[model samples]
Target: MSIFKTKSFWLATGMTLACSVAGVLLAKLPYVNLIGALVLALLLGIAMQVFPQQVRQTAQPGMAFISNKFLRLGIILLGFRLNLVTLARAGVKTILVAIIGVAGTICLTYWLSKKFGAEDELATLTACGCGICGAAAVMGVSPQIETNDEERKRENEVLAVAVVCVMGTVFTLLEIGLKPVLGLSAPQFGIVAGGSLHEIAHAVAAGGAFGESSLDNALIMKLSRVLLLAPVALIIGYWYQRKFVRRSVAQHQPTPKKLPIPWFLAGFILTSVLGTFLPLSAVVLDSFVQAAYIFLGMAMAALGISVNFRVIFQRGGAVFGAATISSACLLTYMVMMAKWFF
Candidate 1:
């Protein structure tokens, strides 16, 4: 049967549209704007999972469509938002801050998760999600790592909530307490905020709350970390081969196919380059960005539909704990680096 004719497809599509719209409306509200549409979508998706089994069954295909298809498209379009000139204005120091901050978070989370004996796949997925761009990174990295389909689905469901909630918590605490607690100047805090936050939206919200100068610098720095996705994904692909593929080959088992560097990364680079040359109108760019965010929210909702709360609650605390600790360390690292180097 054609996917278009399936009830499941339509159900998922409706849910996607509904959740995305709801997320946007929520983001427009006072104070809630900082949490952004992505968080709202994640929450909305999780809430939907509480409905009767038939509803979720009917929505499965459409939710998968949103999670998989919509996700890749949004990641690619995000490239159009990157500008080399903006990155340049933020300076090399801002670039370093992005790189080191991301690296530190990933490394720290991985080590901590391993020490705690979490599953390897779960640890890596959580690390990438928190260290890079939240659910997008988790989804992108999922294919490259060694895992069964069942594990991937669970990771998607669990990480969707775990990662976003951590980011929101971090963003909140920073906004509420960082400046006064750390006694950092505005420009300094901008670098720290840009470098430390996991999601671009969180960073943008934190910086934008400050002022224009801090927002500009923070966003540019955040984009620099976004660009690192290509290299990091590539390295992860290679590492997956060494760790999983080699072992399977030696054992004469079915080996995993080498996942290529995601095509979306190429699109991102191309768009960023093109953006530096033939930039679109600010209004047009903003529209595209908003569209990307809404699509991502829809994808999160789709992913969330599959989550088993029983499974999530049983296994989520360790991963979120590692991420929270990593976030704290990253914030400290970013502040010290920004003060010392910049």
Candidate 2:
């Protein structure tokens, strides 16, 4: 039977949609925008774990479909949010800072996570979330990591996102408080915020706290880091496939027939290029971006439903520790870079 004919699939999909819509609505409440729809949806889904086993069983397939398929589609549409032209206008100094910051953070965070006893896949997801665009980065690179246990993979992804979100919120507050004492110019603070914060929203909030110039610089620096997602995803995919292929050979299992194709990533890159060159109106672009966020929220809700809170509690310590330390280091590095370059 076709997937569309499956009642359980439709039921699960409806649950995700309902949760996502609720998230979006909650975000519209005064000051609730700070939490954002994605995280809200994730929380709602996590709350669903208390539902009856029969209900969970019925929703499992559709939840998996939404988590994987909706996620990729959201990421593909997210490409439209990037305007290379705008990033270029932010200048070479901004670009360099973003590159160095992302690369350094990823390396540092991964090493710290490993030292804290996190597994390889968990460590990698945590690193990507810190170094790139937070939850989106984690979700984007997660599919590349070959894991026989789907639950384990989703759990890692959720843990990584939670760490990033918590760290990002803490740093956002820190940046705001420190801005008055740091005595840096608006643009300098913007660079620091954009380069260090885990999520784009975090950067925006921190940057906006200073001034308009800070917000602009922050967004440019943040989006510049976002632009690197494609290349990073490709590289990780290659490395993971090779590692898994070798493991399979050693165990006398059949190797994968072909290299994995990241069609979603390719679509992202293509969409970005077109958005940069095309004469699209701001309203149209913004609409597409909003749609992407909704889709991502739905995916997050689906992923959250599969997570066991007890498991998260057990593993949270090392992951959170790695993220906090790495975030602090990244903040210091960004401050130094801003003072020296901006």
Candidate 3:
């Protein structure tokens, strides 16, 4: 039987299986769960690429749903893992550091995007998404921007996934390999990993690898950063609208649609808060959260496979520049905070 005939089912099955095996393997390793997930995701993508037609026809829609809707739900579920009381305990200073770090990274990445002349929408998406919360940020902002051309929108989506997958993995590797080699303390590694990694899963994985203390610290720091997504999205939308209006006036065209706020973000915050008070069993909570994470990993792997490797290579410079600036700035801020506070 032809694989393309049952593409979606098989594709989902393949990714789900791959992520499960990868997750298990990583969990067993000492301080390497996050690194394992990242590596497995890339390998899965490469495997899909080698069987392009089979993956394209079978997994495309399933992957789309995962990347779009399921990814957002996963992010919201992640909020449950966060402890609001702990966040409060971290106090105003840590919150301030997180805000400053996120804002500064976004600004730096935006500047780098302009410097590189990267595609406007893609660059803005990367800056906000990668700087804030990876896939969740991208989904939150997708509705605000108007990309009338279906092909262009698809290209942008692919590019967004590619950037997230590649950078998320690389950041995980750095968290595992570099922090210890540099003699970073548990708290230091937590701050660095929490601030610098692109996705919550990767951050959690890195922190878990570091140990229990690092895991707790990193999750809190990462959640604080995730909260910045809404404000950053609003800022980007405003900037884009102003630029669009100016260009429209110059060309005598009508203004674009007003940007919509993402309701999922509000839901995420509320659910996280609610989770704090509910006192749910740890087994139940962990089960749901782990399922969501695995789904996200599968989605990311499928999305990464869809990207044309050559195009990624061609635009490698832009992606590299954004990744380097964002990662470096985040690491620098963490180092500064460690010195000042820890």
Candidate 4:
């Protein structure tokens, strides 16, 4: 087949790009986003899941590509916004805050969820989703969590939805209530929200709610936290690989291979390093950042489209609850960290 002569390819890609455009449009609505367009696109995708037969037949491959490949491209482009000099001079506090917040959330969430009797996969997924970059983090770490049972796989899927949903609600509510309750300054609250919130959308929304400075503070903190995703994945992968190896040896089963570093992390770092020296115009850099948002929206939509709501509700209610609790705890930790840092 000639490269330009495939019906399936055109149809799938066309659908993906169209969805991304819709996402971009929706992002323009006023007061429609305490959440970002990425989340709105996700909601749209989930809504479309009710018509899965048509979607599966025509658009599955392209959706998968956007969620995986395009998402990685966005993460790399994201790096263009960060420079080492900026990171060193102004970002140190935010980076420290992000590290403590993300790292603590992961460990605490995992332990708490297990204590509450969630499955290993459910616990792990919840921790990553809440601890890192919401849907994106969950997607990044997902390659490592292993389960043989059909029920376990389903639990993982439902838990992802649960994590996203809970964070969405909580982060939104926090935007309205946290400052009043805590009496923190805008920058302080922005730091807390960005470090602690589940999705970048939530953090940005929260920041926007406060003002431009808050928005900047929140984004810087959130992106710094995102920078941690690679290290977290490596830690999780190496630990899980070791644990799985020992267990397989005991059961006389073939050991599984260790998880590799996700390629996007490398690209992300490359862009960040290049950004320090690129001297690109602010207009050009802004365009890259804007495009990254669209790509991320499409990726989120792809995940939402894959979910089966009925099955998720029936099988993963308790798993969802566990994730919810884990996130709640993380929010509390984030608030404290923010107050101290700011």
Top TM-score model: 2
Tens digits of per-residue lDDT, candidate 1, 1-342, equal: 987788888888788778888988988886777666776887788788778998998788777767777877777777778888878876777777777777878889888877776777778877877777766677666656655576455654466447655665566566547677776667666777777776676777777777887777677767788878777877888887788877897999987766666776677678778767785888877777778777878887887777765666666666777877887787778778768875
What range of 10 consecutive residues in model 2 has the weakest lDDT sum?
27-36
Query: How would you encode candidate 3's per-residue C-alpha lDDT over 1-342 as one tens digit per residue?
Result: 543456675666566458545754665566555444534554565566666586466677666555556556655675666667877888888788888887877777767877887877777777776778776566566655666664455455556646765687787876688775767798778877787787776788888777888887788888888877767766766777788888888999997766556666676677678777887888877876676566556655655655555655666478557767777677767867865675
- Give TM-scores for every candidate, taking all chains together and pairing residue i with residue i: 0.91, 0.96, 0.78, 0.85
User: Per-residue error at 176 for model 4, in Å?
Assistant: 2.9
- The alpha-carbon lDDT assigned to residue 286 of candidate 2 equals 88
**Which 10-residue window of candidate 3 scores lowest in summed lDDT?**
33-42
Off by over 4 Å in 2: 29-31
Per-candidate local distance difference test: 0.74, 0.87, 0.68, 0.71
Q: Candidate 4 has which clashing residue pairs, if any?
A: none
Whichever of 1 and 3 has more lDDT, that candidate is 1
Better of 3 and 4 by TM-score: 4
Give a tens-digit lDDT track for model 2, residues 1-342.
Answer: 877689877988888887888987897675565566788889999888788989989888888888989999999999999998888887888778778888888999899889989999999999999999999999999988878998888889999999998898888888888987888899999989999998888888888877899999899889999988988888888988998889999999999776677789999988888889999999989888888888998899999988876788799888799889989998999889889888
* Best candidate, lDDT: 2
